[model samples]
Target: MPDAGHPAAGAAGGSVPHRPARLPLVLLRSPWFIGLTVVTLACIVAVFTGPLGRPLDVALNLVLAALDLATAANAFSTARHFPSRPVRRLALGVGLIATIYLISDLTEAVGTATGLLASQETLANVTIVGSNLVLLGLLLRYPTGARSRSDRLTFWLDAGSVLVGAGVITWCLMLGPRREGWSLEHLATALGTAVLLAMVAFAVVRLMLSKRPPLARAPTIWAVGSTFVLYASSLVHASPELLLRIGLADDLASSFLMMVALWTHRVQLRLDPDILRRRRRKPFSALPYLAMAAMFVVVVFVVPEGLGMRSISALGGLAVISLLVVLRQLLAFAGNAQLLRRLDRTLVDLRAHQHRLRALLDHAYDITLTVDPRGRMSYLSPAVERTLGVPPAALRGSRWRTPLHPQDARNLMRAVPALLAAAGTTVTWQVRARSTDGTWRWLEVVCTNLLHEPAVCGVVCNARDVTESRDLHDRLRFQAFHDPLTGLANRMLFTERLIAALTEVPEKPVSVLLLDLDGFKEINDVWGHHAGDTVLVTVASRLTAAVRDQDTVARLGGDEFGVLLVGTDRAEAERVTERLERQLEEPMALDPGPAEATVRVVAGASIGIATRDGECFPDPSPPVDAMLKAADAQMYRRKRLRRTGGGRQTGRG
Candidate 1:
């Protein structure tokens, strides 16, 4: 299933999945489209309307300002979507240029409407010129993906050329309205036109070789085209063919197209869900462009023109516009500074989050680690060094498997890829891992699928030491089935073996011998229980030694023992019983306890035997419990004979 929050489904449904689409095709029909339609209709109506009077001027300027502001909003919205810093810088730069255009247009309109300007080309025209140059400089760095130090160089060089060219042209072609004579105007125009022509040749050559094509070239090209349109609008009074109203309207249309085109990469670089609420920050360098425009205003209207005293009462209005531009620049800088401070706080909070993550890893069982797709360790907790006696740094990278026990490596390696692809599950297995001290340590390892998480885009593993517990469990198992004193199979173990033997085919004859020690209790009565314990231990040792290695010897109970003889006939069973009687007839020496004297007490064996030879019993053998009971009865009968000093004999099958 796809995550509902995602704009498009991913093959993995993870954070930071591939971009939603190559372009937001739906945007063409969205609310922005409708807004663009209304603005276009308004721009066409304003352009085609009647006269060049104050009311038409105010209405046209208001509509142009709205279009410029809408363009800024569009660029800013695109900036908000891009995660790249360079992309945001370029986007917001275009937006700032549009906003300055809005202010400059509104100022000129107001100055014209109030009859305050002697010429339409005032310091407000200077603002338009400077802002257009700024836009051209920023456009040189468009798309921001392919970059070099030369980008900054190209930006400054082209901007300087455009600014100088515009200033000279402004002074030469448009200064006839001012008191400055034709002498200044003719020289400035000729020199500036010649300089611009030379720079154009150089710019064409440079742009040819230095160009890095953008992924979305149309937007930036339109953006550069829009800057040229604004520049052409400023040259409106200088050129007789292009009218002011028509030039400004065309500039607004270009601006709108440029703004729409800026969203080209928005569909390539999708929004980060985590930063949805974060404000897109502007670059510090953006403030200076506005400052330079404000200074342009001050120079054209304040100092150079004697505070506009001769110019249609323009001093007060130009001062207010200049002040407003300066204030807007200052406020933008202040807001950007505040956003930088908030970013610093976010960095501090991120550090605190990392501290908490480390603490959790430290306290959890075992050492934690993350491994990349190639099975190389990417991250290892401090506990890794503490537990494995190897530095975490040493185990990182391609050396991740350096400490794996060779015997377990093949299986673990084979399972790793499948484990990582398991999505949201865990796999567990035990392996013998090599430690720094040259010993193999058993580890219980658990690996979880965390490949979907960007921070942990790999498998997370936790390995804990279980060597001590494993050893204790083995020892407990041994003690449960073996006799403590003799270290031989006890009654329970012997019974299980007997039952297993009965289940097998009776082709091979078998015999069970039940033996009671003759006069064994008398040794305890004379010497003490300590001496008797020593006697029983010695008898068990002799019993084990007397039989073939494959035969079973068990301590059934106090002073009684049982033996299983495989592949034995009636005659062979009798011979084995006689040999067991002779082996126990010898005397055994015992050390009773500390400081107690030695007592050499003698003991003999009374043995009973049961055989399954198919002659005495039916086709099938008797059950293990019934066979053992019959053997015990025969052993008591032998005990009577031993007490009466009768001859040694074995029971027939």
Candidate 2:
């Protein structure tokens, strides 16, 4: 048998369960692993060019050529998979440019070493310019889906700036080899360089001002800006006098660009952890390190006079700084990864605890339910069957209105939609439910919305059967308002009747009759309290039969009783009182063969009347108490008159 906690196994009638897809281990590690390694190695090679000399230079060039080729191949492969035609074309353009650059670099290295086709060096520079222009155009033409018009314009401007930079490089290559005095190539190179610099400055300003997704833009601008500044400053350094000024700028720009590249690569890797982790292994960078070492060697061996020492020192410092920054970035990456892992573990533990708590709630006696904003049940606990005789499965996906009594359903349906609108609030109401057994049961329910929670994703209702308790409470309430011994309205109920009558029909003439059964205490003393109870029950029945149903007959303790008659005049009250007195005078029957010993009990009752204007009694202050007091006083006066030999008078004056 399978464990009850686990999802039920698929059988003839069981539901098939879905399993979550597992994340690949490699995907979780880093996103820019390949890109970062390539860029870092390239920077190292550039830095060490002065020390490593010919062999190291050749090796670094070969490495660069290989990386450029790989980048082109990868770009083409990715382009083939892209959904957008424009984006695919742009990607293909970038790949082609990269391929051209790779070939040029390889041929340039060969020509430099063998000294055979030295003319190709200038051609290689031209090829570099053409490739850069093509790459920039591709970057501009790359489709950014559904961007604003302004963004499209800005993208084009930025790409144009990069193309302008390529034009400057082309001009410089044409002029540097010719060295002709004041040539068009030389002037054009300076002008193009100035234009490119201005464009870069504008782009930087835009970057600072714009409030867009900074992740892609910030690093891209920083890398391009630093590269422009470094190359421009290097060109400005012609003689010893200009060298110091330009060399400082060159050093600052180079160092800044390297640092920026390192930081940007780290951010990209962190942002996309999956791509970095999928790599088989980190690429080697020994050639770049060797190239950097050789750059230092060349600086030491063949030192150019006038500010060469300062240039070498600056380059050395930049290389050291770049190395330190790379190490720092790596450490930070590792720390962030560790934190993410810890957080994931904590979340797993929390989910486990939540499951255990849910298990406990599922078995609880009280019916627990979860609903959506539409008031449809999202979840219903097992206790639904025990409490309402409704299965949990039957309740799920059903609207709450279905289970409610028809009379109550209309109001509940109206209220629930309004309640759902105020999500995260608690709403409570008493509802009559139609049980599975076809009986109506009252349930006190409290609903709370769980819409605020990302996981809970719905509203929850906690309900329990309160029918038995409510019925018991109502019974006790009824008993409080009636005399337990006689089953007649007690003082409390009588008072309520008198007040209601006084307020409702004050001008119509209400009579309050206070009755005392003569010799009732003597009868109780002669007989037991049980016999007295029997007599009281008999008296109650007689009073009920004598008075109109609208009139109230109450046991006001001992042998005293009270009645409230609505719309009765003083004459009518007198007639009613005379009849009640005559009926009591004739009654004397008891149980157990009492024809000879039958008690001769004569009972008499006194009555009092009061009338007021209906308008005056609109805000009647304790009207029942005032009426009862007036009746009591009059009843005493009549009793005194009878005791003093006053004849019974039936006429009302």
True-structure lDDT of candidate 2? 0.59
Specify the highest-TM-score model's number.
2
For candidate 2, write residues 380-483 as lDDT tens digits.
88888888888888888887777888878777756654455544667898889888788888888888756656677566788898999988987898799998
Q: How does each model score on TM-score?
A: 0.43, 0.47
**Per-residue lDDT of candidate 1, residues 1-653 (tens digit):** 01122211232455775654334465654676567657767765666575556786666667667767777777787778666675577678868987897887788678878888667666555765577567546544454221555444434443343343343334333333455535655556645543543243233222322333222444545545553454444344544433666665765666666655554434333433333234321232332243245435535653554533223223333344345445545556666798799999999999999899879987766878877655578878777667778777887884445677876876776665455444766899787877788888788889887667777766688888888987788788778877887777889988887777767866777788998998878888888887788888888898888889988999888888999887776678888888888788888998876797876767888888887778654546677877788788889988898778886755653
TM-score of 1: 0.43
Scanning candidate 1 in windows of ten residues, the lowest lDDT window is 1-10
Separate clash counts for every candidate: 0, 14
The whole-model lDDT of each prediction reads 0.64, 0.59
